[model samples]
Target: MPKPSAVTEAPSVVGSRLRQLRQRQGLSARELAHRLGISPSAVSQIERGVLQPSVARLIAMTDALGVPLAEVFGGPEQRDEMPEDLTGFALQRFGQGTEMTLESGVIFRRVSPGRTPGVDYFVSTYPPGSAAHPESGMFRHEGYEVGTVLSGELTIDFDGERVVLRAGDAISYPCSRPHRIHNTGSVDAVAQWLIVHPER
Candidate 1:
């Protein structure tokens, strides 16, 4: 038998973050849904992480909440005290960044020391045979993603097309396209992801 992959299960923090921001703004779920032009159940699903929001919806959500896009992804301090100068810099040591796991069993480590404008950086690890979406399904969001495989193998499926990548291989694509990534190899796969979001 083959050895088990390094990753097992990972959980996403998006729902928690959404809930936190909503409460901070003193908006109830129904009120938020009304502002977003979505149903209350839809808002519930998003806040519960049962459904992921599209890029456009995410922008509308931030606008409704009167917060920057980075506020949604940043820690409490970063959200509260976002620097106005992009030139300001900080360092993040190995294993020191914010870590999260998605429902798909992928581990994500935020690489930046704190929230920066325009982009979100992450190091992701996928377990063998694991996928970002269910088989034949896909997920779409906002922004552009650039990634390179660091170890094992990664398979990206965009629409009906599939591309397999080995270590050192890289890919860049729009997040608007329906897509998913899978660990097709028999070992854990690690990759670095850079997601660029539109300026607010």
Candidate 2:
């Protein structure tokens, strides 16, 4: 079997929507950068699609803008426009979902057709040597994650303990733990991840 290739193209919509959100929040690029502890030029680069932020940075950006991460991916406005299905179901066709390739070389594609209150469903691809937290090594949030490795190998580090997962393996853990996801294999590691956010 052939190894899955890395997804290199990041949709420009993410950048544009982020910019719109920042502007709508009445924040200048410099102010946003200050809040993110990054340079103004870095913010501009990300907003213009010249640079792609790592997942951590993107999350911080959205939080600083007083919006949920989903807002960066079309948000409630887009979700509200989906064609109604009295049958109570909708489909998220292949390539129709939002895709973003981070600077760490990880690709996150939202797979859920619409909002699932406090839930996030997505496919994540981690290229060889890539890590969810490239610098910090670990981070924690308010939620829980359940994921299964579709291919390649991935390692999850919780504090000092490390758990390795191979293709077809699955794991579930609380997001409150300081952890990091790393691709330790030579091939791209792809997984379907579901995150259930803590109630607000």
Candidate 2 is scored at a TM of 0.79
Model 2 stretches with alpha carbons more than 4 Å out: 1-11, 74-77, 82-88
Candidate 1: C-alpha lDDT: 0.72
lDDT of 2 by residue, 1-200 (tens): 54334233444667888899999999999999998888999999898898888776776787678665656665547665445543466666555676678878898877777656677787888999998876856866656889999999998988879999998999999877888888889999999988787666
Which has the greatest lDDT? Answer: 2
Candidate number of the best TM-score: 2
TM-score of each: 0.71, 0.79
Tell me the tens digit of each residue's lDDT in model 1 across 1-200: 55223222122366668778899999999999998778999888877778765434554576677664456554576553436775666665554455555545666665666656678776778889777664557766667889999999999988889999999999999988988788889999999888888666
| lDDT of the candidates, in the order given | 0.72, 0.78
Error of 1 at 198 (Å): 1.6
Clashing pairs for model 2 are none
Quote the positional error of residue 29 for candidate 2 in Å. Answer: 3.3
